[model samples]
Target: MDRAELVELLTPDGLTLLDSVGETDAVTDVVKAVSRLRAEGHAPSLVAAVLTQVKLRRKAVAKFGDFASRMLFTEAGLEQATRLRVAALHAGRFTAAELSSVADLGCGIGGDAMAMAAMDLAVTAVDADEVTATVASYNLAPFPSAEVRHARAEDVDTREFDALYFDPARRTAGHSNTTRLTKPEDYSPSLDVVFDRAATQPVGVKLGPGFDRSLIPENCEAQWVSVNGQVVELGLWFGALARPGVSRSALVLDGEGTHELTAPQDSDDVDVRPLGEYLYEPDGAVIRARLIGDVARGLDAGMLSPGIAYLTGDRDVTSPFVTTFRVLERLPLDERTLKRELAKRKIGALEVKKRGADIDPAVFRKKMALRGSESATLFLTRVDGKHAALLCERVR
Candidate 1:
């Protein structure tokens, strides 16, 4: 990975070093060679292939704590990496038929571009960072129609693209210590700017799952995608790529099941009822999509509180959009008595779920120390500003 080694790897003479070696060993040697080249200030493209080769080896990637020391990703960016990749793949699925040519703006490491190219789409990937663009070029080399360009999204020519994909930088000028998007406007190229430009062509913009729902544009269709019950990315689609009457959708996907529920745009007052024998708490994405009412109607359930997201019904309902739980009992949130009762019932392990309760479940669990009992779900919440616990089982 030193200067001479990097030069050899990039030159015609060094090309032979990459040949006649096993594929696995070649990848390792390439990474080592590229790391040395980078240390020596060699051209970015010279190390692109090696970096991408490392990325492809999932086990070789740095762990969360080690990422800052080794990789270039910010802590917040790393936290959302898996979710972003899943969202990008899911969002791409929605527009697979119409996407012939795509422009991946801000193509970090070219993960999305690689996925799109795998789907047989011609992609022109662009990134402002020279190193990132070089990495993208090497990552996308397997696809015939894929090309990497060094440029900003606004400066790139959009005429040749059938669709545009954007993942904006969410950091601020003075805040290097924090990785989360501090302000809504921090979204790179800004959501408004991306949308305005995308109005000229099909566009897909990725946002954090935690983004405020009120900020979603009216013209675009917003989708909240969850993989294996974990809420991932939020996506906005514009132009011809948009779906009709589907302003928002909550997608819950698992190996054996997939559920998609769309929210109604028209707001109407719905009645709230008691937490019946069966209660459903939709995923965070479903709540963000404003699809609670739709879910209630579909499941023949009623709201527990006028503005709350909880839905209740008299009978067990099967739905992938939400987790259905049967209420076993409701009790006070007294640590001592609750522990006693749990022990009496032989419930050992607890899965704590909280809403509107200030108590820390971890501390509470430690204090209880009911190790001999079976597993149980403990729901902590404030009912009329009073804390309570509900023992329940997943209705599924």
Candidate 2:
């Protein structure tokens, strides 16, 4: 949006209109709301903007909860903003270190800045884009300790702050339709520059979960965090901000609560064993953290294959770090043999899962000819490096 449009949206009257049309659920409701406002003498542009913001705020409830109602979000900024729950954990690192001030370089809509400020810390939140900085300012308006600046992150004087936080923009060029830029050097402010600052000052760098392992600095602590079931982001902590004696960690947050498995280095690998009565799929955070071996050892299980993340055991041991499945029957990899085997068991509805395999579930399911009285979880994976299928039931 242009500067004037944004300025208009922030005006008392426009915000009142947005607040009045709070949390629209359907297109019909939005249309009705917008029509009512337009009849009340509001401009079409103002009505359109307010209706859009209300929809975004409602969708944002998943990430920001009730705070989303008051906060403003740009499309790209909202997509990249850290979830409030995870931001609180990031803030805890600074809080534990007794750091009172932070510079959130490349801050998107001030999610992290809001969390830090709530914890009684001073934050200088900076973004290179003018529109983004304004949106961040609106979101952080209640936090007087936080300041938003529109400037290149590299130009910001880092020495003035107690700590630095970087969540560099990783989108590929075009603003209209964007793709993820994979190379670290392609990142704005460059990974090299971020690492350089980390050497002299405390730094926390947020990166993609699948970031190249070779580039991870020797002195930094690498952490993979998973919310619910999905792996979200990889966080690198350096110097005083780094957790003591913890070089690699996997943090899992689900309905139960937060649980972590940490190691000073990559955990020892386990030997491959024959398929057992049960199968376990490790959480994405565990796989990304390269701590699959640690989880396997904890459950007294062995790997199904040398490189596969799937584990097998004769016992039904359960851990918060791994999802368990009970193996019902092993079927031939060939489609005909699998169909015959499944038909005998009267399997119907299917939940296809795969890892270390090339087969597509959608295409494979078409061949199953599902028409039975029962439902089952079908495992499409390799057994000792050979294609195999296991009909199973979810333990949960």
For each candidate, the alpha-carbon lDDT, in order, equals 0.67, 0.88
Which residue pairs clash in candidate 1? 1-36, 346-373, 346-374, 347-373, 347-374, 348-373, 348-374
lDDT of each residue in 210-315, candidate 2, tens digit only: 8999999999999999999999999999988998899999999898998999999999779899999999999999998899999998888999887988999988
Which residue runs does candidate 1 get wrong by more than 4 Å?
Answer: 1-56, 59-99, 172-178, 266-270, 383-386
lDDT of 1 by residue, 1-396 (tens): 232433444455334333322445435576666666568665566455335334433332522222222233322333334433363454465355466888888776566776677677787888775655654565567678789999978788788777788888665422125456667776667777797887687888878778877778788888888877777778888877677787888888776666777754733424677667877887777787777777788788887665666777887876787788888988898888798888888888888887767789898888887777478888887444456787888767
How many backbone clashes can be found in candidate 2? 0
Over the full model, what C-alpha lDDT does candidate 2 score relative to the true structure? 0.88
TM-score of 2: 0.95
TM-score of every model versus the real structure: 0.77, 0.95
Give the worst 10-residue stretch by lDDT in candidate 2. Answer: 22-31
Prediction 1 global C-alpha lDDT = 0.67
TM-score of 1: 0.77
